[model samples]
Target: MMTALLLHGYASGIYSSRRIARAAVERADFMMIVAGDAPDFRTISEFRRRHLKALADLFVQVLKLAEKAGLVKLGHVALDGTKIKANASKHKAMSYD
Candidate 1:
């Protein structure tokens, strides 16, 4: 769903996220999700509010790791598209901001 919104330019909304999540579930096995079904709008909304900063920090850490691994070079473009999923449930998260 993040990929759908960020990369594929899908509009951000419950239905858009749900649609992407449901499709990924049908093609399962590689998808990492709790409940293995489309999440409710509240869940998705809360996740973004709670986890966006942490995820951004993680992304920076990944880039530093790549540089240390010699995978990053000046004047060259590279993007590692893999994402780690956090099992955020509505009951387990709080709004830290």
Candidate 2:
């Protein structure tokens, strides 16, 4: 349940422990994940500190799953108003003048 809350928070671009803790009480999605038992910021921070690596691994897994489900592509790129030399190759995106 806690993991679910944390993951949901991160996925929603809320990286602050205090924000996630507050969301657990205020946001419907977070409340559902926590089942009304909201953890305080300290608890969330401690969990994140202790399991930082594991959480990162899980996040990567989640992103992979999202990609597989066609929600996102792993390495999609977008260029805007940028000029690329016609001679540029894949190895060299752009050359410095």
**Worst ten-residue run, lDDT, model 2?**
88-97
Query: Model 1 over residues 1-97: C-alpha lDDT tens digits?
Result: 5423322213223344456555445545314433355555456556656877875676567667878899875366789999999979875786656
Off by over 4 Å in 1: 1-20, 29-38, 72-97
Which portions of model 2 miss their true places by more than 4 Å? Answer: 76-97
lDDT of each: 0.53, 0.89
Best by lDDT: 2
Scored by lDDT, model 2 comes in at 0.89
Across residues 1-97, which tens digit of lDDT does each residue of candidate 2 receive?
A: 7788888888899999999999998989898998999999999999999999998899899999999999987885887998765955756876575
What C-alpha lDDT, on a 0 to 100 scale, does residue 3 get in candidate 1? 29
Model 2: per-residue Cα lDDT at residue 42: 99
TM-score of each: 0.39, 0.74
- lDDT at residue 69 of model 1 (Cα atoms): 96
